[model samples]
Target: MASEEVVDLEHQNHNFHFENGPAAAIFSKATLPVTLKFKDVIYKIKIEKPGKFVKAAGKSEERTILKGISGVVSPGEILAMLGPSGSGKTTLLTALGGRLGGRLAGSVSYNGRPFSNAMKRNTGFVTQDDVLYPHLTVTETLVYTALLRLPRVLSKAEKTAHAEAVIAQLGLTRCRNSIIGGPLLRGISGGERKRVSIGQEMLINPSLLFLDEPTSGLDSTTAQRIVSTLWELANGARTVVMTIHQPSSRLFYMFHKVLLLSDGNPLYFGKGSAAVDYFSSVGFSPAVAMNPADLLLDLANGVSTGENGEDQAAVKQTLVAAYKTHLSEIVESELTDCSAEPPVAGDDRTLSRWSNTWVNQFSVLFRRGIKERKHESFAGIKVAQVLIVAIVAGLLWWQSSTSHLQDQVGLMFFYSAFWGFYPLFQAIFTFPQERLMLEKERASGMYRLSSYFMALTVGDLPMEMVLPTMFYTITYWMAGLKPTAGHFFWGLLGLLYGVLCAQGLGLAIGAAVMNLKSATVFASVIMLTFQLASGFFVQNVPIFIRWIKYISISQYTFKILVAAQYKVGETYPCGGGGGEVCLVEDFPAIKPVGLRGVSTAIGAMAVMIVGYRLIAYLALTRVGALKK
Candidate 1:
């Protein structure tokens, strides 16, 4: 029996291996060698300075971030960029990786040809901070990325196999099922998260990989492991360029070449092993125990107290001039040789911006959105808030009678305002929170903007509808407003539509600003404007300012709820006199003008929904495409 149990266990392991076998083969066979070369790359930014009291206020200055930097990174090489803060290592990497925005001087090429969008498709970039969905498990994260990024030519099984292979390759199999948690939740460690980031880029089987401080926040041991992984990747014939600060001696030795920068200027660009010798030739040498990376950085930044005892500025000048006079020729020679090589023959066409069709993208993104929304902390908070508000409102206006017409009308208006304001505020954080992830995926050509927008809209609808439904169900019976089935159903529909409109407006605000604080301030201003013009607060509007009433969704919702309760033919007791109260004649405030029927109010709400969502989609697309 024990032997049989062991056999069963071995069979399960065999099945797992078989499932991921093809993916390992694909990773080994699919990569193409790419050599990246940059020449005289200069990057500058325009900054506007607030002029002093007497000077012009809008004066602008051009700050150069990268000044004529040049280098070549061949296949099977790992180039480490060492520099102090603001030394242009990141700027240079961004430029070389095709992520830099604005105008850049000089040329960057891939495999002897001018850099094109095609090269970008074949390249990968790992940002310093890992931006991932906090609720997804490691395997789920990689599977989704594969589904969205892998070529359409591959089957679903093939893609799953590939994702699994990446999990194994990155040494993440042990924690594959663990959730990627954030500050609010418990999950994987920082090192594991960084590996996940690397695994995400590896999904494409990229030839060129750029990482911005992959080891920035890791412990020394973890940092060495990450660098070792890069070293292995480089040995596999991939070109890896990364910016690192103060690495250990073992990590420094793993790099094939090093580019030392100081104040946007290259002080040295050569082999990692020869950097110490070059510095020694320039009258600076470190002790045997000193980390070469630290020594180089200190020398580049003019902080090294060498044998020459030169001034800081003079030391910087000496290093920069030495590179220009001696090492620049070597770089130029390599660049010329790389540029002269012929292109590799094959189908080198660029991948499409989206791997999946629009429908598929929407479907996948919708599923992802639903998963994220279901696990979000705010979802529970929203339900709690809804229940609390519903109970409070119900108690405040308990079993309202027709004799108290003012309180009933005020209650209906309050319902409209509550639904409107709540949804608007909830949606303001949506786009801002996901902006970084969205931008990273979009820049990598993973999916279209429209697919994401539609998916988000559809996914949020079910959750969005649930809270309002709960709110209305609790408040409707408790307050005793128009208990008839027709009236209750129509009121529910109107309330739901009002919630959608408010949420759409919030999405637009979030997308437009892409900052939580700024979006909140802007949304608050708009919400206040709409609230004041909702017709409940200010029924008698001046003719010149009356247009505001037409644009206020709250006003439309209030009109619908009142019309649903007090139909044109129905009459109720007015005040305590027991006289007939006709809605059109008794209460001018609740009377419907053009928004008399349930259909008209529903139609207006639908229009607002489409208009605001369209604006939000456009704003998000614009922000996502804006490169810095």
Candidate 2:
């Protein structure tokens, strides 16, 4: 099956020439080529010892991931890093792409000069997993990326044209209008999704492209086509660097240069085809019909023996020494020549930052939020859950007369607590799931953190309004609460505010921990704490902890709902004596605090929303910077 797939891919490549596509036309409008060079680059990270309580303050052992690896990749060439698992190929690629964060020694230059944020703007990096919105159509995804990434010089129409060109170039015309769906929803194929990922980076026509396992999870033919497309891209005077696993000989020979690594050290770095000859000189020869990439991996893994009767380790040592003596000199000489040349001047530097205004970013993110939520949140299951819960609660309370004022209070408190818990739990997954994508874009300087936060807060309002409104509408009339429109509206407003506060708290928890499981656990603890202090379950005040109620959104929401249902002048039959009972005596929970008006409750909720969201934003900013 794999062989057949490979043949089919070759046939497709014959029929579909990437260089003849609209993307080629787009790339033909040239900018100066990029040359990326890294010299003696060493990247190390700290390793914390577990269960070592006696360790000194601010101290930990350090382990190097990449040790003094050096190489140069010039425009119009493809440099592929090949090695065994745990060999640091991806780390080296990331380091060259300027994405790795840690203690580092050595220099990486672009166009014969040190790298800057401006240079990264003109560079593209594609990760193994495609981080795209599954709900957005292919065209819509590309269009949005173009809007956010393209320069202001390009008009809306021009950006749209560019997006269309990229779609055509990637051969995604058939699925152009199809959603990029995932596990639950059916949408584009895996190969098509990979192409869409590539197309996003291509929208900006980057001068240098870096990919980590771009062909992973694809059949041989699909992988070949991807590499072939990348080759065409390189032919357009763009530098291409990627880390790849085992490749067929046909695919292996396609790369202009190949760097073989073993244990974070370079074993060989030279022309891809010349690798065979270089190894042959080091007393290592491939058997007849053996794939060069396979042989290289075997050598790097210390699983192969050489003709000189030495084991794999000795062979690797010889190869590394040979490359240092032969290939390293060539790379250094080339870097010197390239450095003598002057740098290219252009306005491309400014494009490194956001291409759109703050308002524009907020608008784009707002639209994205709506589209994502429409797919993930408004499904039949979610609506059914809300309706079922509302129905159950209403049935349990069952239209009690004012005589059963205790039951009414219980129902209102349940309403407040449930809304708070449900929304908070649901929102905990939001930031953790998007952390990788957000980190990537943020590192690229795509948009401000504040813009994204505000967009999320505003975009969620409509959907947030929906579930609670549906819930309250069914329960309010069914449970036989106050029937006046004024009562219903105020109660609904109070519940909506409760949902906002809960969601804000969830965002803060999610942002602070950067892990779904941790955030969920943390949010649960917070919700439970709020519930205990909400004034619903416990009325007696332990003076020392009574202040907890001031910070409980559930408490305020309950107060507002109770006040809305029972007016100041209203009276209810109580004490089972057919005597009228005053509102204050009937519900003593809010009496001490005076059961304030709806506005006061709302003001408190507003404060919670702002405070929690501010914490969320700050947490996200700090975590994003701290993440490697």
- Per-residue lDDT of 3 in model 1: 40
TM-scores of all models? Answer: 0.92, 0.92
Which candidate leads in lDDT?
1
TM-score of 1: 0.92
Pairs that collide, model 1: none
Clash count in backbone of candidate 2: 0
- Mind giving the per-residue lDDT tens digits that candidate 1 earns over 494-610? 788888899999999988888899988888888777778877677677889888777888888887878777766555665456564654434656653423565766777788899
In candidate 2, what are the lDDT values of residues 1-628, reduced to their tens digit? 3544433432221121244643345655325578888889898988766555665666679898888888888889999999998999999888888877778789998877666655665778888888888889999999988877766555677778889989888889999999999887899988888899898888877888999899888889999989998999999888999999998898999999999999888888879999988887876777666889998998898765445455767766777787787778887776677644345333342322455679888888899779887766788899999999999988988887677777887788888889998889878888888787787777666677888878988888788789889999998888898788998998888788889999999888888887888888888887888788877678787999998888888888888888777767667765577575665534665564345556777788898999998888888878744232
For each candidate, the alpha-carbon lDDT, in order, equals: 0.80, 0.80
Count of backbone collisions within predicted model 1: 0
Which runs of model 2 end up more than 4 angstroms from their true locations? 1-24, 52-59, 307-312, 339-344, 347-352, 580-582, 589-593, 597-599, 625-628
Number of backbone-clashing residue pairs for each candidate, in the order shown: 0, 0
